[model samples]
Target chain A: MIELQQINRIFTVGDQQVHALDHVDLSIQSGEYLSIMGPSGSGKSTLLNIIGLLDRPTSGTYLLEQHNVTSMNDDTLAHTRRNKIGFVFQFFQLLPRLTALENVELPMVLEGIPPAERRQAATETLNTMGLGERLHHRPDQLSGGQRQRVAIARATIMKPAVILADEPTGNLDRHSGKDVIELLEQLNKTNMTLIIVTHDPEIGLRATRQIRMVDGRVMEDNHKR
Target chain B: MNTPDFIRLTLTAITAHRLRTALTVLGISIGIAAVVLLTSIGEGIHRFVLSEFTQFGTTIIGINPGKATTAGGSIGVFGTERPLTIDDALALQRIPNVQAVVPVVQGNAEVEAKGRGRRTTVYGVTSGFPEAFRFDTAIGKFLPADDPQAPRALAVLGDKLRTELFGNENPMGQRIRIGGDRYRVVGAMQPKGQILGFDLDDTVYIPTRRAMQMFNRESLMEIDVMYREGTAEKIIVKDIKRILQARHGKEDFTITTQQQMLDVLSSVLNILTFAVGALGGISLLVGAVGIATIMTMAVRERTAEIGLLRALGAHQKQVLTLFLGEAVVLAAIGGFVGLAIGVLGAQLLHMALPAMPVHTPWIYVVFAEALAISIGLLAGVLPARHAAAMDPVTALRAE
Candidate 1:
C-alpha cells in the first residue's frame, strides 16, 4: 500500500519556480495495477520518481507500506529503494560494460549476496526471461527488445514489493512493446503492485486502475474492472 | 563487496582504457626508476668514499705541526712554529693504547734509476708505516727500524714505481736517486691501489728523518699514531694533547681522529644521497600529476558508470575507495616494474664498469614503493571525491 498527501515538487530554473508536481494527493492499495497517463510536463514522471524514492517531494507525507519515507535520510531512502521498489526506465539504463547476466547480478552484488547463489539466481532469472542463450551478450551486442528484457530482469532481481515503470516500451518496436506490456501484466496478476507511467492510451487502458494528470494535478481516476 | 570482487571490478575499469592506463603507469615507472638508479649511485659513492678513507685503519690519529688556528693557511711549512720533531712521534708511543707511531713527511720529487726518471710523490715515514697503515712488502723487507733521529739511506719502491724504474728486475739493493740523494731500495710494496685519488702504488717511501733532510725542512710534516682497538678515541686524543702541549709549552698542533673525519664524510654523503633522491622525487611528482590528470578524465568519462553503481546501492565511500584502489594499484605495479628495471640497470652498470660502485639499499627500495603508492592515493583524492559526490539521479539522466 502507498499513500501521498499534499505532495509538491518545485524546481527553480534560473529565477523562475516551476511546479513540476503541484499540491497533489493519491492513494493505492496492495496488488493494484495502476497506470498514470499525461502529456509532457504533466508531472507523471516526477510523481513516479517521488514514489520510487529517487527524488524527494518538496512538501509531502508519503507512506509506503504504512511507514513514512519522506522524512528518511538519504542512506535509509537508498535502502528502501533497494529492498522495496524497482524502477524500469524508458532507456533501459543497463551498464554497457556488463553482459546481460552481469547486469542482472548487480543488485545482488550490491546486497552482498554470495556469489554462487547470486549467479544461480541470475541464470535462472535470465532463463525465465528467454535470455539464457544470451547470458554473456553485452547490452551493445543485444537487440532493443533483449536489452529491455535484461533491464526488466535487473529491476526484478531484488524481488522488490513495488515495480514502477516509466515508458518501458518507449524505445521498442510495437511487437516487442506488446511483449513487454504482457510481461508486466502477467507480473501484476501475480499480486505485485505495478504502477506504469505512459503516454500510450492503449497501454494506459490496459491497467485495471488508471489516473490522468493535467498540468501538475491529477484530473481523473477510473477503475475499469 | 568482497575484496576479490572489488579488485576485479577495478581491474575491469582500468583495462577498459588500456592505452591511457599504460601511459599513466609508464609515467610512474619512469619516475621510480630514476629515483632508484640515482639513489643507488649516490649510496655507492657514499660507501666507496667511506671505505677509501677507512682503508688506512680507523683508529689512527694524525697530528699536524703548528696550531691549526694560529698558522692560518701555512701550518705545515717550516718556521710556522716549533716544527713537529721525531721526539714528538716518540713521545706519543708512551701513551696508553698506543700501538705504533709513524712520523710522516711528504713531497713530490724526481726519482732516477737505471737511466729511467719520473716525477712522483715521495713519502718520508718511519718503519712503523707498514703495521700502522696496513701495507705490506711484496718481494723484500720494509725499511729497517733504525734510530728515528739518524737512519740509513734506505728506500721502499711502490709496486708501480718498481715496475717503471726497474722493469720487473729485482729492485732490492738497487740504488735510486730521489731528489739528488742516492738511496738503496730495501723493498717493493704490494699493489695497494688508489685512495681518494692519491696513488699509493705510484710513489716511494723513505725514512722520515731523511725525507725531512731531502725536502730541506726542519719539522716533521705530521706524526700519525695508530691506537689499539677497544681504546676510546677520547683517551688517546687527550694523552697526545697532554704530551704535545707539555713539550711545545702550548697546544701548537692539531690532532684529527679518523672517527671525526668519518663523521664529516658520512654526513656529507648522506646529504648527497638525499639531494639526489629529492631530484628524482620531482619526476615522481610529475608522474603523480599525470595520474591526477588521467583520473580526472576517467571520472568525467565514466560518470554514468559511477551513477549505475550508486544506484545499485554502492555507498559513497565504496565509490571513493574503488577509484582510489585503481590508482594505487596502477602506481604500485609501476613501482615494482621500475624497481626491477632500476636494480637490473644498476647491476648491468656495475658489470660494465667494474670500478664504479653501485649499491641499492633495501630501505630505499621499500621507501620508494611506499612513496609511489602514497603519490597515487594523493593523486586520486580529488577525482575520486568528485565521483563519489555525484547526484545519482542527475548522473543517471546524463545519458
Candidate 2:
C-alpha cells in the first residue's frame, strides 16, 4: 500500500520555478497493477522517481505501509529503496563492466548476501528471463531485448514489494517491448504491485488500473479489473 | 563487500587500462630503484670510511704538540708552543692501562739502496711503533727495543719502499741512506694499504732519536700511547694530561682519543648518506606526482562506475577505499620491483668494482617501501575524495 498527501516537486530553472508535481494526492492498494500515462513535462516520470526514492519531493508526506518515508534520511531512504522497491529505467542502466548475472546479483550483493547463494539466485533469475545462455555476457554484448530482460531480472531479483518501471520498453523493438510488458504482467499476476509510467496507450490499456496526468495534476484514475 | 571482492574490483579497474597502469607503476619503480641504489652506495661508503679509520686500532691515543686552541690572531701569531718530547712519551707509558707508547717524528726524505734512490715519507718512531700502531713485519722482525734518547743506526723499509729500492733482494742487512745518513735495514713491513690518502706501505721507519736528528728537529711530532682494551679512554686521557701538565707546568699538548675522532668521522659520513638519500627522494616525489595525475584521470573516466557502485549501495567510504586500494597496490608492486633491481644492481656493482663498497641496509629497504606506499596514499587522497563525493544521480547521467 502507498499513499501521497499534497506531494509537490518544484525545480528552479534559472529564473522560473517549474512545478513538476503540484499538490498531488494518490493512493494505491497492494498487488494493484497501475500505469501512469501523460505527455512530456506532465510529471509522470517525476511521480515515479518520487515513489522510487531516487529523487526527493520538495514537499510531501508519502506513506508506504503506514510509515512516513518522506522524512527518512538519505541512507535510510537508500536502504528502503533496496529492500522495498525496484526500478527499471527506460535506458536500462545496467553497469557495463558487469556480466548479466553480476548485474542481477548487484542488489543482493548490496544486501550482504553470501556469494554462492547470490550467484545461484542470479543464474536462476537470468534463466527465467530467457537469458540463460547470456548470463556471462556484458550489456554491450547483448541484444536490446536481452539487455531489457536482464534489467527486468535485476529489478525483480530482490522481490521488492513494488516494481516501478519508467518506460521499460522505450528503447526496444515492438516485439521485445511486448515481451517485456508481458513479463511484467506475469510478475504482477503473482501478487506484486506493478506501476508503469509510459506514453504507450497499448501498454497503458494492459494495466488493471490506469492513471492519467496533465499539467502536474492527476486528471483521471480508472480501475478496469 | 568482502576483502577479496573489493580487491578484485580494484584489480579489474586497473587492468582495464593496462598501458596506463604499467606506466604509472614504472614511474614509481624507477624512483624506488634510484633511492635504493644511491642509499646502498652511501651506506657502503660510510662503512668503508669507518673501517679505514679504525684499522690503526681504536684503543690508541695520539698526543700532538701544541694546544689546538685558536689564538686571537692568524697563524704563527701565537709564538712556537712547547713541543712534545721523548720524555713526555716515556711519562705516558707510566700511566695505568698504558700498554705501549711510541714517540713519533715524520718527514719526507730521499732514501738510497743498491744504487736506486726515491723520495718517500720517513717515520722516526721508537720500537713500540709497530705494537702501538698494529703494524707487522713481512719478512724480518720489527725494530729492536733501544733507548728512546739514543738508539743504533737502524732502518725498517715499508713493503712498497723495499720493492722500490731493494727489488726483491734481501734488504735485511743492506745499508740505505736516509737523509744522507747510512742506516742498515733491519726489517720490511707488510703491505698495509692506504689510510686517509697516506700510503702506509710507501714509507720507511727509523729509530725516533735518529729520526729526530735526521729531520733536524728537537720536538717529537706526536706521542702515540696504546692502552689496554678494557680501559676507558677518559681515564687514560686524564692520566696523560696529569703527568704532561706536571712536567711542563702547563697543558701544552692536545690528546685525541680514537673514539672522539671516530665520532666526528661517523657523523660526517651519516650526513653524506642522508643527503644522498634525500636526493633520491626527489625522484620519488616525481613518481608520486605521476600517480596523482593518473588517479585523477581514472576518477574522471570512471564517474559512471562510481555512480553505479553507489546505486548498488556502496558507501562513500567504500568508493574511496576502492580507488585508494588501486593506488597503493600500484605503488607497492613498483616498490618491490625497484627494491629487487636496486639490490641486484648494487651487488653487481660490488662485484665489478670491488673497491667501491655497495651495502644495502635492510632498514632502508623497509623505509623506502613504506615511503612509497605513503606517497601513493597521499597522492590518491584528492582524486579519491572527488570520486567519493559525487552525486549518484548526476554521476550516473555522465556520458
Candidate 3:
C-alpha cells in the first residue's frame, strides 16, 4: 500500500552536505507491522518522516495506495496525510490546553466533523483505551502512560491505514512502555498497518518485519512473519 | 473549520494569556475613546456656531460698499468707489423674491435719556431691520416705516439700554439725545443675546438716513436684503449686482449671500472635527501596534500548536484566519468598550459643564468601530502570514 523508489533526503549545513537518507528503497503491504531500528543520526526517523509525508525527499517517487504522492501539492499532501496516515511522536504532541477527549478529536476537528458525533467517537475511543474516566483530564494532569494512550487514541481516531510512531514509548516508564506496545499490537491485530522507529532492540524486535539502518542506508532487513 | 469552532479556538488562545489580551484591548479602547470624545466636542461646537449665525435667518444677503478686491496699490479715498446709499438699498427691492431690505449704518455715540447718559452702539437702520434681522420688540414696536431718505428723528432702545436709561419708566414717546440730536424713543427691543462678544442687547436703533447724517458719512455701511426661502441665491445676487452696477456705473459693491458664509463656516468646522479625529487616530495607531506586537508574540509562542494544526489538515488560510480572528476579536471588543466609555465620558462632561457643547453623531460612532476593525486587520496581517507560512516540520520541533 506504500512504496518509495531510490529516495534521497539531503540537508545542507553551511558548507557541508549531510545525507539523511541515501538511495533508500522500501515498500510495505497492507496490515504489515514493521520497525526501523538504528542509532541516533542513522536516519530511521528521517525515513519514517518521509513515509509519513511530513518530509519530502530531495529525489524520490513515492506512491501511497498506488497514487503518486511525490509530486502532490502541499494541500493535497496534507489531505492525504489526514485521510491515510497517523503519527504518534515521542513527546505525545497533545495540546497542553485541551483535554484528552479534545486532543483525540483534533484530527476530526480538522476534518470538520460535527461536534456531537466527534465527541461521542472520541469518548468511545478513550473508553476502549481504558481512559473512560480520564477523558476530561489534560495531558499535564495525566500520567506518562495515560498520556501515551490519549496520543494513540488521537492517532487512530481517523482510522488511517498506516500508523507512524517515532519512539512512542521513549518517554514512558518500562512498565508503561510495555503497555503502549501492547496497545499498538492490539490495533495491528485489527488489520491496521503499524510502523515503529525505535532505538531499543527489545521493542524493535517485536515487529513482524524488522529493518536495521546504518549511515542513512538499510543494513539489515529480516522478516519473522 | 466551522465558524463556531474557529471562534472557540481563537478565544481559547486569547483567554490563555488573559493579562496580555486585556492590556492590548485597553490600548485600543483608549484610542477609540479619545476619537469619540474629541469628535463629539468638535461636532457640538460646529452645530452651536451654525445655530448662532443662522438665528438671524439664512436667506439674507449683505451688500457692502467698496469692492473688497486686492488692489495693486493703496488708493485711499481717491478710488472712485460709489457709496451704497438708501437709493441703492431701495434698488435691491426690485429683485425677485425680495422680502425686506434694511439700509444699515452703525457707529458708537453717547446717548442721554431721562438725565442718564452712556456711550453705546448706535445702529442707523430702517423699519425692516426687525424683519431682516429677526429682531423682535418687547414693548411698543420696532422703527416705523418712515421715509428712508428723510425720516422722523425716532429711536428704539435695546432691552438693556432701556432698563439703564428709564429705570421702570416707560421709554416709549420719551425723548433721548443721540449724538447731540434729540429723538423720541419709539420702542424697546427684546433681549437678543450677544453674538461673538458683541452685545446686541446694549445697542440703540435709529433711522439709517438719520444716523448717516449724524455720523457724517457719505456711505451707507451695508445694505441687508432678506429674501423668501427656497429662492436660489445666485438669481438675487445677479439682480443686486446688475442694479447696483447700473446705478453706480460700475461694480463697486461686494454682495455676500448667507449660504456662502455658511459654506465657508461649514468647511472650517469640518476640518476642525477632522483634525481632532486625526489626533485620536494617532493613539489608535499606537493601539494597532500593540495588537501587532501581541499577535507576533502569540505566533512565536504557538509555533508547535500551529504545526500540529497543519499536520491535522488545517489549511494555511485556516491558520492565518485563526490568528487574524484573535486580533479582530480583540479590536472589536475594545471598540465596543471604548464606545461606551467615550459616550459616557462625553455625557458626563456635558453635564459637568453645561456651557460646553458636545454631540456624537451616529455615523462617527459607526466609523470609529469600523476603523478599529480595520486596524486589527492591518496589524494582524504580517504576524498571521508569518504563522501560516511556517513549515510544519520545523514548527513542530520548536519548543
Candidate 4:
C-alpha cells in the first residue's frame, strides 16, 4: 500500500518557477494493477519518482506501509527503496559493464549478501524471466526485448512488494512489448502491486484502475476493472 | 565490501588504463630519483672534502693571527711585521697536553745550489715540526732538536724542491742561500704535501734557534700544541688559556681544536644538503600535481559508474575509499620503484667515480619516498571527495 498527500514540487529556472507537481493526493491498495497516463509535462514521472523514494516532494507527506518516509536519511531511503520497491525504466537502464546475471545480482551485492547465495538467487530470477541462455551477455549485446527482461529481473530480484514501471515497453517492438506487459501482468496477478506509467491508451486499459494527470493535477481516476 | 574484493576492484580499475597509470607512476618515481641523486651529490662532496682533510694528519692543528677577519677566508694582512719566537714554543710545551709543540718563524727567500737559484719559503721551526707537519722524506731527515745555545746551520728541501735545486746531484751536505743567510742542506725533507692551501712541500725546515736569529725580531705571533689522548682539546685549551691569561695578563689569544674544525665542516655540509634537498622537493611537488590532475580526470570519466554504484546502495564512504584506494596503490608502487632506481643510481654513480663515494643512505631515501606517497595520497583526497559528493540522481541523469 502507498499514500501521498498534498505533494507540491516547484523548480526555479532563471527566476521563473515551474510547478512540477501541485497539491497531488493519491492512494493505492495492495496487489492492485494501476496505470498513470499523462502527456510530457503532466507530473506522471514525478509522481512515480516520489512514490519510489528516488526524489523528495517539496511539501507533502508520503507513507509507504503507513511509515512517513519524509525525513529519512539518504542511506535509510536507499535501503527502503532496495527492499520495498522495484523499478523498470523504459530505456532499460541496465549497467553496460556487467553481464545480465551480474546486473540482476547488483542489488544483492549492495545488500552485502554472500556471493554464492546472491548468484544462486539471481540465477533463478533470470531463469524465471526466460533469460537463462543470455545470462552471460551484457546489456549492449542483448536485444531490446532481452535487455528489458534483464532490467525487469534486476528490479524484482529482491522480491519487493511493489513494482513501479515507467514506460516498461516504450523502446521495445510491439511483439516484445506485449511479452514484457504480460510478464508484468502475471507478477501483478501473483499479488505484487504493479504501477505502470504509460501514454498509450491501450496499455492504460490493461490496468484495473487508471489515473489520468493533466498539467501537474489529477484530472481523473477511473475504475477499468 | 570485503577487503579482498576492494583490493581486486582497485587493481582492476588501475589496470584498466595502463598507459595513464604508468605515466602517473613515472612522474612520482622521477621525483624520488631527484631526492636520491641530490643527496648522493651531497654525500660525495662530503667524502671528497673529508678525504682531503684527513691526508694532512688528524692531530696537527694550525693557528693564524686574525687579519681583521676579512672577506676572502682570513687573509694575512700585508706588512704584518710580527713573527713567532722560540720562548713561546718552549712555553707551550710546558702546558699539559702539549705533546711536542712547535712554533715557526717564516719568510720568503731565494735558494741557489750550483747556480740553480729558486725562490722558496724558509721556515725555522723546532725538531717536532717533521712529525706535526706529517713529513715523509725520500732522501734525508729533519733538523736536530732545538738547543737554545747551539745554533745549527741546517736546511731541508721539499722532494720537488730538491730536484729543482740539485737535479741528479745530492743536495744533502750542500748549502743554499735564503735571502741573506747561507744554510747547509743537512737532510732533504720527505714531502709533507699541501694542506688547506699551505704548500708544506715547497718550504724549507731549519732549527727554531736559527729562525728567530734570521727573522731578526720574535714576539711569538702563534703557538701550536698537541693534546694527550682521552683528554679533550678543550680541556687543554682551558688550561693553556688560564696559564696564558696569568702570564700575559690578558685573554687575547684564540683557542680552537681539531674537533672544532671537524664540527664546522659537518655544519657546512648539513646546510648544503638541506638546500639541495629543498630544491629536489620542488620536483616532488610537481609530481604530486600530476597525480592530482590524473585523479581529477579519472573522477570525471567515472561519473556514471559512480552513480551506478550509489544507486546500488554504496555509501559515500565506499566511493571515497574506492578512489583513495587507487591513489594509495599508485603512490606505494611508485615509491618502491623509485627507491630501487635511486639506490641503484647512487651505486652506479659511485662505481663511475671510485675516488668519490656517494652513499645512498636508506633513511633519506625511505623517508623521501614515504613523504612522496603521503603527498600523492593527499593530492587524491580532494578529487576523491568531490567524486563522492556527486548526487546520484544528477549523475545518472548525465547518462
lDDT leader: 3
Q: Which stretches of candidate 3 lie over 4 Å from their true place?
A: B70-78, B167-170
**Better candidate by lDDT, 2 or 3:** 3
* Per-residue alpha-carbon lDDT of candidate 3 for residues A32-116, written as tens digits (9 for 90 to 100): 9999999999999889888988889999889999999889988898888888888888888888888999899988988888999
Please give, for residues B235-332, the per-residue lDDT of candidate 1 as tens digits.
Answer: 89999999998998888788888899999989999999999989989999999999899889888888877776776667778889999998888888
Give the Å error, residue B3, model 1: 1.8
- Which residue pairs in candidate 3 collide? none
lDDT of 4 by residue, A51-160 (tens): 88877889999999999998898878878887888888887777665789888987876677778998899999989989999989988899999999998888888889
Winner on DockQ between 2 and 3 is: 3
Best by TM-score: 3
DockQ of 1: 0.49
Docking quality class, candidate 3 = medium
Candidate 1 Cα lDDT to native: 0.89
The candidates, ranked best first by DockQ, are 3, 1, 2, 4
Task: List the DockQ of the predictions in order.
Answer: 0.49, 0.41, 0.64, 0.29
Judged by lDDT against the true structure, how good is candidate 2? 0.88
What DockQ number belongs to candidate 4?
0.29
Candidate 3, residues B1-399: lDDT per residue as tens digits? Answer: 778888877887888889998999999999999999999999999999999999999999998988877777778855889888888888888887999999899999999977889899999998888888888999998889988888999999998899899978888899999999999998899999899999998999999999989999988889999999998888888898889989999998888889999999999999999999999999999999999999999999999888878776777888899999999999998898889989999999999999999999999999999999999999999999999999888888788
TM-score for each prediction?
Answer: 0.91, 0.89, 0.95, 0.74
* Least well predicted 10-residue stretch by lDDT in candidate 1 chain B: B71-80
Rank ordering of all candidates by lDDT, starting from the highest: 3, 1, 2, 4
Task: Score residue B108 of candidate 2 by CA lDDT.
Answer: 97
Cα lDDT of model 4 by residue, B1-399, tens digit: 667657766776788789999998888887778887788788778766776776645665554443333345434543342333455456667876666677766777777778878888877676776666455566777777747547678777887788788777888788788766788887877666676787777877776667667777455445667655577766677776676656555544566566778778978987887788777778788878888998999889888777656655677787898898888888777777777788788888878988666866668877977887797789899999998898876665565
RMSD of 1: 3.1
